[model samples]
Structure formats: structure tokens, C-alpha cells
Target: MIHDQSMQRRRSRIRGLFGVTAPTDAPADAHTPVEGERARLLDAIRDFLLGNNLDISAANLLAAHTAFSGGNPRLRRRIGERIAAGEAISQFWLDQQLRDDGKSDPATHYEDMAVRLQSSVERFRDTTSSARNAVVSYGRDIASQVETLAREEPAATSLLREKSQGMAETARTFEMRLLRAEREAQSLREELARARRDATIDPLTQLPNRRGFEAVFEEEFRMARSNVEAMCVAFCDIDRFKCINDSFGHDTGDRVIVAVGELLKTMGTGSCHAARHGGEEFVMIFRGFTTEQARERIDAMRIALGKRRFVQESTGDVIGKVSFSAGVADVFAFPDRRNALRAADEALYRAKEAGRDRVEIAG
Candidate 1:
């Protein structure tokens, strides 16, 4: 009851501040000034609502509520008076939303998703390691028992032969167990490795998916966050990919994607990780280099991709050439990979917006 009363009191005060007095037995003309004030408040509210982020909106709303509660005694008195007169407060300022500024972009989503995938891979790794450990422990115990039996029964020749055969069987059993353990370990390693790779990489392009790029970004972020190491992240997408897909079949389009992936992988050989971020989008991370340096290096790859001739395997028809737009961000200045990822993404958007097949760096 107390909570409801408090909330009711709060709502009344909000309405009064908005110049909404209780509709009462008093003359209708009594609300003329209040109606005028309400119009002005609404105008101010609209202006405020137009330019707020969620955080700012929340802060301002709380401030408005607090001011309504304590700052205007007339408003407070009117609120109490309205409640006594049984007026219902109907309006609230909580539903307003500012425009989405896109602070949480696709790259951010990918990074979070990749982390979860990697954790699952790690669990697989740990489980496999435990199994290997158990196998080794059992093998060691059997080997110890076989050795002790051989040493204690050295004189009984036939018995000794039986012991020898027993020891050989034990050794073979141990070898088989060890071999199984090794194979299982290898399989587990491969499965976990594949899982980890799949988490971040696009299967088609073999490039880092958004998830993969995010992992690289985070690693770079941690590296930068810890030390003075520099990193560069680049966001790229095939130019006119949709047009190519539309003109040609999806199979040819897929071939182009695969070709680009192969070229990018070969081109990004040392200290660079490249991935298919999403759709036709690709991301690359270059370690130990300035954005300028990385740009120069990647520019060559861009040109190579642009100039490369791709023929439609079906008709042996020339598919013309492919090109890409790229945006590069450096960790030297930004330091945070998340910020760098965002920067690169924004730059890539700008590059695409300006013109295709060009490189743009984050300012």
C-alpha cells in the first residue's frame, strides 16, 4: 500500500509538472495558463527527446522526476490535491527512444559469439586431456605390475616363460592403450581445433568470419591493453558482389568468394589473419605494423584481387575482374580492438559510400 501510494504520489507530481491539473468542479477557464504551460513543456520535451542516447535519456528522465518531486512546491501541492480529488495520471515519459547510433555493430556481435564458441572448444580440449591422463595412468600401473612379476619369478623357467609371455602381452596391451590414447588425443585436438576455426572462420571463403575477426581484435586489444604492441585491422568487402551474384549464378559467385579467400590467405601469409567476416565482408588483422604500413601491404593484395581474372567454369566465359573496398584501423592510436574494429567498419562503410574499390582509413 505504501509503495503504491508512493508511486501514485510520484505519478501525480509528474502530471502536475507537465501542467496537467485534475479535471475538477472548478471552472474550465482555471486551466488556461496550465494548458499554455503544457504546450511549452511538450515542445521542450520533443526537442529533448530528439537528441538523446539511451543513457542520457535515462539520466534526464530521473532528473525530471526528481525536480517534479521536490523543486516545484506548487506542482507538488497540485499533485496531492489531484490525488485527493481522485484524478488518474495517464501520461508517462518512459517510452521515448533516441535514434540508434549503432554503437553495437556486427563486429561486436561476432566477437562475443566467437568467445562463447572458443570456450566450448576449450571444454572439449580439457575433456580430451583428462582422458589421455587417465589412459597414461592405467598404462603406467599395468607396466609396474608386469615389471615386478618378471623380477620376482626369474628362476621358474616354464613359469619364467609364462611371465615373459605375460609381460609381452602386458606391453602389447599398454602399447595398444597408448596408441588408442594418442589417436583419441589427436582426434580430440582436431575436433577442438576445427570447432575453434569454424567459430571464427567462414567455411566458404576460409576467411575470418566476423566472429574470427572479433577474436583477433580481442587478442590485439589484450596485447595493446597490456603492452606497447601495435596492430592493424582492416575491413573489406567485394565490390559489386551482389551485382556479380545477380548477373551470374550463385555457384560462380561462390567460386569468386573461394578464389578471393584463397588469394587473401596467400597474400596475408605472415603476421596477418584474414577472415570472411559476414556475407561478402572480410576482415584482416595485421600485427606489429602501423595502419599505414599495413595499408600499403594490403593495398597490393587489393590490387591483385581487383586485377585477377576469373572465368565462369561452366561456359569458360570471362567474368571480368573483382575489386574490394577496405577500411583500416590501427591499434597504435586506438589501442582497443573493439574500437579499432568499429573504426575499420565505419571506414569501410564510408569507403563503400564514397565509391567502391577504394581504401579508407579511420580518422
Candidate 2:
């Protein structure tokens, strides 16, 4: 059931990306014209790329086809704008925008281990303390009985010695049990922490994935509401990212993504959080920034990215520049976190509609 739901969601996203509507009851043949048009556009894009010696990556081809099919007016307009800005449009340039994996940090692992060990130690200490107390009480009772036996019957001294030995042996056994429990708990805690970190991070980009972002968002939302402070959420999508993956290959795409991730990490500090939302989209949280301030910061990043150039190291070919569109929203202005995210997403759509490499603030 979960798999089916996931597949349906994937199909929905594909349809949305390609500007296809949900299926209707019409006969399959009724969609032939549309499919044929898409095919023709795809062929045309292929031919154009080949004629111009452009890199023919799948993402680039798809972007070109989508633009030619008139399915995505925003993408078409973005292409035109790039040309107008005196930037050379090529497969290499497009490939420079779309992009990935990784080992766990030793520091984080050690820190988690330390915390687990500390908790285990504390637990063991408590258990040992309780056991010690029990032993002390037992010893007191044994001593009292021995004293009585000594007074009532001096001949029972040998039996009293056996009883004291038994009590001492029991205390030793309890201490061992506590030590074993501590070891087991420590092992379990380490595994749990490692699993949690793996689940929350994107293996490819080494950035916090969607799940992690949601957790952070919820926490920030709660804090903002409690403090009555302003917070902003911004959604960013790389422009023509598909083209980058198509042109240079997935490896190059991965490099591009890593570069972007590093840049985001640098930008996301001082009460701000940045995460890879999925694919070529990223989301950021700004704790103290208003919508306008968030927009300015995002726009600045967009400009910075656009100005940076990527190069194919092996061939030393310039890959041109990459850009992104962003939308920023003031979370406090919305009724809930969900509403704030929706508002930011709508604003991002507007930014893309206006042009790529720009930022829009939700009103």
C-alpha cells in the first residue's frame, strides 16, 4: 500500500513537471496528438543540440523539449532571458547547474558515543547505588541476627559465618548484573543514534534531507510562536537544473549539487538552517529575518551563484553560470507552518514565472 501511494505521488510529480493533467475517462487514443507533439518537440531539440555540438544530457534534452513544446512558459522565458543577458547558452552551461554521497562524520559519531556512554554510566551508577544500599541493609540484618545468635547460642558461630559469605556473594552477583545492563544499554544507544543520523541526512549531498528539514521547521515554528518573534522560510529551485544533469552527466550534476550544498552551509548560520528539500530544490529557515530581509538574502545568494562559473576540469571547458529562483515567507504572518510553506511555494512559483535567478517575497 505504501509503495503504491509512493508510485502515485511520483507519477503526479512527473505529470506536474511535464505540464500533463491528471488522467481522464477519455479513450487512450484521444491523447495521441499531445504525445505526438511531445515526440516531435523532443526530436527537434535533439536535432538542434546535435547540430550545435551541444552536450546531449537527458536533463538538458528534457528541458529543451519542454520549452519547445510550450508546456513550460517560465522555462522558455528563462532561456530567452539568459540569452538577452549576453550569456552563451550551451549544453555545458546547463549541465553545470543540475547535481550528489558520503561517510558519517567522526566527530559526530564520537560525540554521540560519548553521550550514550555517559547515560549508560549514570544508569549503572544508579543501579549500583541501589544494590549497595540493599547490600548494606542485608548486612545490617545479618549482623543483627548474628549478634542475637551469639547471645542466645554461641555454638551457631560457624552457621553465621556461612550466612555472611552468602550475603557477600549475592552482592557481587548483583554488581555484575548491573555492569552487563550498562554495556547493553550503551550498545543500543550508539546504534539508535547512528540510525537516526543516517535517516535524517541526504547521502548524496550530505545535507539534511526533507525529513530533517520538517523536524527543524517544526521546532523553529514552536520557538517563533512562543517568543512572538518573526521567522522566514524560503524555498529555492535551481533554474534549468534538468539540463545540467542531461549535458555533462550525473557525475558533473553531483559536483554541482555538492558545490551548492557547501555554499548553502556557509550561508546558513547564526540561527538559520538550510536543507536539501529534494532534487534541485532547497529550503532555508531564518529565525529573525522578515520576509523582505529573507528575500534580499536569498536574492543575494542567487546573484552570487549566477556570477560563479563552473569548469570541466578534464577539458578545461567553461560550463557557464547557474542560477536559482527563490520565494520567501514570514512564518509568523501565517496561521500555521503548513500555510507558511504553501505561501512560500506560491511565491516561488511567481518568482519562476517572473524570471529565473530572482527572489519573491510572499505578501
Candidate 3:
């Protein structure tokens, strides 16, 4: 909703004021001091939120943090390029990137869905409470009328019959209303449950998403600690995935993703835990495996996938061999899981630099 062309006019001021550039764009010794870099990142995040009229909500801020925090180099490059080209960054664009990158949820979709569900629950509670009170009050009225009629007063018998008829009709109407309310509330409850489940799943690969992966990781971490078992975390990324997207289109690219996800998913069917970390990136946790052991397992998957040739379904064009690079780190060797994962990512980068379709183990 924050899309506006006029907002781009301020982008010129941003570039001239803050000399923020990605590592690829800067010279070898162009690194800023750590404090200076931090300040620039903070300023960039604040300016991105305020300048684009984007809300300072969790999604926006998270996207901003990821873009500037060096966690997502591609996102940073994209933002810099857009600003350099005098294009305004919109909320829609940010949300699309979030969906694409797996950094966080898109916009406020989940949060808003949660709020709506909570509101429905409260309304349902109120409706049920009101219906219960009405039933109790009606019961009291009926008892009083019955007691009076038992007094054998013939003078009021006709009036009592008329009042009893009205009460029956009123009770029927109330029951019907309560039944309708119950049905509606039940449907809403089912929808809310689905929404919660959907939030943790990746629609593209039918795999657990980043959030889902974290949940799995936390559980596995506790288990590994208790059992005194060795654990390894691997970062796997498709080699030159953008080239496939450009050559065969996103549909073929998706097939490639599905192929890799399926193989990893099969691994998860066993003791391993696998998830889609983001675009073209998958993470896996292997319990009771050393770094080299995990590397061999991942390399086997890499070789198996590389042996298969893909064809574009529409044009029958050969999409060539698809393979991925992976980096595995022994979780027990690191101080924490986060550091171990970070080391894995760094090793993955080294694997890409050395060659595609290979595996590297973090030392």
C-alpha cells in the first residue's frame, strides 16, 4: 500500500548523503569502520521506513534489517540498485522479496490474520454467554407461570394459555439463532487453525519453511543435548539458480527446486531434518553425524541430482543438469547453534567460490 512515484524523489538525497555500497561494488580496502558501518545501517533502516511512507511494523523493519545487516546480500544489492535508479521501494515490493527470500512473513498477513481470528473468538464467546443468560431467564418465566396456573384460578386460565403459546415461539426462535451462531463459530475456528498451520509451511516446495525449520531445530537441539549425540547442520544452495530461471523460465526453475526438495525431504523422512531456508537455499540438520559424515551424505544427494537431466515441459528444451553446493558444520564444535549455522553458511559460500556442485565442511 505504500507505493508512490513521488516518494522516489527523495532517493537522490539518500545516495548523496550516505555512501552505502555492497561489497561487490566497493574496492578491496573500501571497508568502513565497524561503528561507522553500524551507524550507516541504522540510518538506512530508519530512512527506508520513513522515506517510503512504509509502516514501522515488524515485517518492514525485519526486511530492512535483513537488507542492511549483511544477512541478505542480494536483497541489499536490489535495494541499492532501485535507489540508484531513482525508483521508490514500495511495501508490495518488500513483501514480495520477503516471500521470495524467506527472511520473514510477507507484510503483516499472519499478524492481521491472527487479530481477526482472536476477534472472532471473542464474538463467539459473547454470543454464547448471551444465549445462556436468555435461556436461564426464560426458564424462570416458565416456572413462575406454571406455579400461578396450579393455583386453580379460572379467571386467569385463558391469559395463561396465550402467554404459554408466545413463550414456546420465543424459545424456538432463540434455539434457531443459537444453532446458527454455533455453526458459524465452528467454521471460523477451523479456518483459524488452517491459517496457523499454513504460516509454518512453504507453499512452493510443500516443505517446512524458515520458521518451521527453527521450531524443528530448537526441538532437535534439546534432544541432542540430552542424548549426548553428535549433530551437524548443513546449508545447501542451488548452483547458479538464477541462470536456470532466466533460461527456462520460473516454471522449469520450480521443477528443479521440487526435485532438490524431494530428495532432501526423503532424508527428513529418516532421522534428518530438512527445510527450505529461502529462495534456492535449503538447510538440514543431521543428528549423530560428524561433519565429514554429513558431507558425504549431502554429496551423495548432490551426485544423484546431478545425474538427472531436466526438460522444459512446454518447449521440450533441455534444461541441463541441476546440482547444488553444500557446507556442513559439526554442531558440537561450536558454542551455539546459531554460530554453527553461520559457519555452515560461510563454508557454503566458499564451496560456491571453489566450484559448483560440491560439498565443503566447516573446519
If ranked by lDDT, best first, what sequence of candidates would result?
3, 2, 1
**For model 3, what is the error of residue 241's alpha carbon versus the real structure, in angstroms, after optimal superposition?**
0.8
lDDT of 3 at 211: 70
**Each candidate: what lDDT?**
0.60, 0.68, 0.75
Across 152-267, the per-residue lDDT of candidate 2 in tens digits comes to 88798888778877886776677577666656766766676677667778777888877677788888888877887889998888888888888767677777888887778877
Model 3: how far residue 269 lies from native, Å: 2.8
Question: What's the CA RMSD for each of the models?
Answer: 16.5, 12.9, 8.0
What are the models' TM-scores? 0.50, 0.59, 0.70
Could you tell me which residue pairs clash in candidate 2?
Answer: 57-246, 57-247, 58-246, 59-242, 59-246, 60-243, 94-244, 95-244, 99-253, 100-254
Residue lDDT tens for model 3, 116-166: 776878688578758856875786788587668857787787787787778
> Evaluated with lDDT, which candidate comes out highest?
3
Model 1 C-alpha lDDT per residue in residues 1-363, reported as the tens digit of each score: 986664444444444433354422222333565565445344333322332222345645543342232222112233333434565422332222111111212444455655665576556656655665665676566567656776786565456566556756665676566566656656755775665556555667756665566566667667655777677888777888878888888898888888778877885655687877555666788877788888887788888887789887888888898998888988556523444565676577567667878889888
Candidate 2, poorest ten consecutive residues by summed lDDT = 99-108
Q: Which scores greater on lDDT, model 1 or model 3?
A: 3
- Higher-TM-score candidate among 1 and 2? 2
